[model samples]
Target: MKKYLDIISDLGEGFGSYSIADDSSLLALVSSANIACGFHAGDPRTMASAVEKSIENNVGVGAHPGFPDLVGFGRRAMDLSSWEVTTDILYQIGALHAFVKAYGGELQHVTPHGKLGNFSVVDQRYAKAIAEGIAMFDPSLIVVTMPGELAEAAKKKGLRVAYTIFADRTYNDDGTLVARSNPHAVIRDPDTVVERVIRMVNEGKVTSITGKEIEVNGHSLLLHGDTPGSLQLAKQIKNALMSAEIEIRRLGDWIN
Candidate 1:
């Protein structure tokens, strides 16, 4: 049987005077949060406030590092060297870790944000660079994402690894996420996404965009915070899981 999951979402995505979602409200729903670390979508004040909110709600805080693409919101991939990727990861982790420590909370994990995240899944060099940075921090730090070369790289470095399944994104026949550029890539239908989430938790599988069953279960489920009615969707998923006798817990609690 599939184990219970850790439902997590992105926090600290807003910067300056702009806000994407009500993170304070999101904290009350998710068990963990991937707070943006200024590269992709957060500023210093935003990160600090996010840390405080997570601490208040007892939600696990993690570093959400991206490709330093503030213009594209980290969704655009950048051509970077292995060294650049390694240092970027370390820099972002350290920046978030400082706030987490100041607020008397632990940095639960490191989840690469946006295209940097997707690249690590298929690119061995990117995976290794990210892994090397995590190992430098503390070889046992938890790394959360999909099961791929990233997880493998972390395991080889004595780091804890946990996979993530997107609650709204569709997978491919090869088990990778369907490129977001495609119109059908994101399942905006709340009912459909909710049902797929339950199936993944209970059956350990996700139907690809091409209509194939893929082994895509994970310890964590990634929910987008910026989407409209996101909190309502989160509530639905949480309620459904609870009704089905599944415990919604922090990803760090069950990371391997």
Candidate 2:
């Protein structure tokens, strides 16, 4: 059997006239796109453009919901009730899905953004709330998450889960991502990132910050569009995966 891997990137992370990353270039290399909804780094125009571009590229369009922290880029944690989290997620997903619908495409999945994503991994309440929001929106939507609280919650909700690993981020010994506050949390070397991803996809293991090999059943590898030299790196990673005989595909097509 041929091993499959999906490369996804966060996109439409621009507001008004200010843009971040070359979405057009990144879209060409990625198999899936996690389009930012209006909460953190997107607006109505940006969302619609992202959806249309993603559809044109034949990429899977997933909603990337974040906390309403535009200044902080949704990387800062927020204090909110479970109802708030669920409702906020539902709203964000709905807003993006509208554009997808207008573009004659269905949403592929949901991946929480930044701090909300980090919290959902460790906090069960947040995990359950996010799962509830996604299920409420569409039970058929795949939940792209790490192996943690959110994964468990999504599974219990009968939602298909696509376990993901960040290609540019480092992991802790316990399987959670290392905090971005740590200077070494993100690995910028393209060669190293490609090597690690190949290993993780083929061997189901990733090396943590502590240099410990941690097992991870990853179906998707996430790349950040905003990272410097990211476009070239994404190309290299895609080439490396192809060279290694791994199939690069959209998650919605195969994840079960």
Candidate 3:
């Protein structure tokens, strides 16, 4: 396999068989998939099918756990306690794991989805609880987290952390992701996203929304399948990374 970063594709809420767009794009570019685990988007059938497809394409499978908020699409922040967050996360991961196991494939990692992910980065206690829950369930499973804060918290909790960057999102000067509510937060331009990622991987720097240089590290890159033109973006990103001779790997491979 060609050694620089891992790429994961996110399959978002209630995406059933009709998620052909997501399925096709995920199979084509990503080495790993962060599949929605019921709470936010997928049903049992959808989870099973996604796991089967991942196996068929030799892609790594990961549980994408989110708050139980299908109505909000798990985007709205909830006032869940750390215990509640842990339980919600475990429930989602366990359900997805059962499906993957029944299909005779292993779940390689856990990535908190949507609002839960954002909260985990800023709330050390919440991040610790999530990491602890994952470690309790399967110590071998890698925890895919935003680079810096969340990763640091997971590491402290004895969970293997896969520091991730977003291929289609903007960053702030503080190295945190720009809030999604902001107009410039999502990188909609395919060429611009590709250019930014290239600089991040090759130069270890990203130009934040404020036009300030910020240092960042990425073990994996994510493409949100829900975004407009997500499929095209994934294809372009894969091609650009290959042209730059950066190897793409699954989070599992790195953790193992």
**Leading candidate by lDDT:** 2
> Judged by lDDT against the true structure, how good is candidate 1?
0.90
Write down the lDDT that model 3 would get.
0.82
Q: List, residue by residue over 27-80, the lDDT tens digit for candidate 1.
A: 888999999999989999999999999998999889999999999999997999
Task: Return the TM-score for each candidate structure.
Answer: 0.97, 0.98, 0.94
Cα error, residue 29 of model 3, in Å, equals 1.3
lDDT of 1 at 159: 86
Per-residue accuracy of model 3 over 1-256 as CA lDDT, tens digit each = 4456888887534555445346855676889988889887888888887888887788888999988887787888888887888888788889988988888889999989888899888888778778877877987888888765567777876778888888888898888899888999898888899999898888889999999999988888887777778887888888999999998887776564
Model 1 vs. true fold: TM: 0.97
- Alpha-carbon local distance difference test for all models: 0.90, 0.94, 0.82
Ranking by TM-score: 2, 1, 3
lDDT of 2 at 35: 97
Among all windows of ten consecutive residues in candidate 2, which has the lowest summed lDDT?
A: 218-227
Candidate with better TM-score, 1 vs 3: 1
lDDT ranking from best candidate downward: 2, 1, 3
